[model samples]
Target: MRVSQSMKPENAAKKLGILLEAAPESFREGTVTRDELAALQADPPEWLATLRREGPHPKRVVAEKLGISNSGLARSGITDPLTTAEIKALLAAPPEWLVTERATQAAVRAEKVRVAERDKERAARGASDARRSGGGGV
Candidate 1:
């Protein structure tokens, strides 16, 4: 259930066997952005926008306390202001898209297994019936 880059943190967490709850510190002023994201990643404004649109919490409350414009923060795409340890807490977090794709693949595999088992059972039953009727010609 790892979340991938394309997956929303919440969605990814669910798949990765991680639980998403209200972060201890709501996104407010003094909240430190993850250094890696701050350094390695830049300008996640679009993600912020998506979060605002999709999130359950109030975007304005989060933005105002953080001293950022609602639109600006929304566009910033900063999902969680997690520290290194907090980020690590997201066990097996894959990018969002990967989790979805992997789940889909697993479902397909399960279906195939089910179909194969059914076919095998049907063949076995048919063979048993043939034997009982003395239908096999030598």
Candidate 2:
């Protein structure tokens, strides 16, 4: 388990199989070590716990957090995780792109729900129609 003292935080996070953007500031502040990296994988610290809770998350997590899809993230050019501070800041003063994406996400969710309900109604109608038309000579 060899580790360089001057290893970049991002590289260290990569070595640890974690996204640096998802890591807490404390984790980024400290120099990464093989032992520490292994320890984090085996047993995480407070910073690690925080990172797990409030993430610079994976693409899936990011999408869910933002209520948007990966395609939205791509369209918005959001390749990195937004920190809690960053998230708050954006919420306080959302950019046009963020606003637009949120609207799109809302519309998408609404459409999906509407489609599901419609499908359910159609299925129910079909079942009732089958029962009504199920006439056979005794």
Candidate 3:
């Protein structure tokens, strides 16, 4: 006996460029077969095409296209998903909060990289010191 392959609804929604909660109830209720998913991607149905073309996209995608973090969106009072048009409008005429959030996100990313590099240097120094002190043998 062979089992069929299937993807969870949440993953399908992500691939489909929509929030799971925004997807149709029927789509949300069932697992998607690999073949079905492929077909959807190859020649999407009206709903899928509409969503991909003119999205009420998920927060992650929204943040990516907006060049900001998900938390930045929340801090700017954007708790709901945004359509492509809305995203474009904001990009064309960015508000003060958006500008501030973008800077904050950049600083946060820079700080993360700085911390990671510092930790890597510390680890390398520790390893070098251990070797020089002949500390490995018990």
Among the numbered candidates, top TM-score falls to 3
Whole-model lDDT, model 2: 0.73
lDDT of 3 by residue, 29-125 (tens): 9799888888988998888878777888999989988889988888889988899999999999999999998898899999999999999999999
Candidate 1 per-residue lDDT over residues 75-112, each given as its tens digit: 55645543333323332564454344445556766899
Question: In the order shown, what is each candidate's alpha-carbon RMSD?
Answer: 18.1, 8.7, 2.9
| Arranged by TM-score, best first | 3, 2, 1
> lDDT tens digits, residues 54-115, model 2?
66656555666666677887898877766666666777888888788889989998999999
Pick the winner on lDDT between candidates 1 and 3.
3
Q: Where in model 3 is the C-alpha error above 4 Å?
A: 5-8, 21-29, 38-50
**Lowest summed-lDDT stretch of 10 residues in model 3?**
15-24
Is candidate 2 or 3 superior in TM-score? Answer: 3
All candidates' lDDT scores? 0.46, 0.73, 0.88
Clashes of each: 17, 1, 0
Candidate 3's TM-score reads 0.77
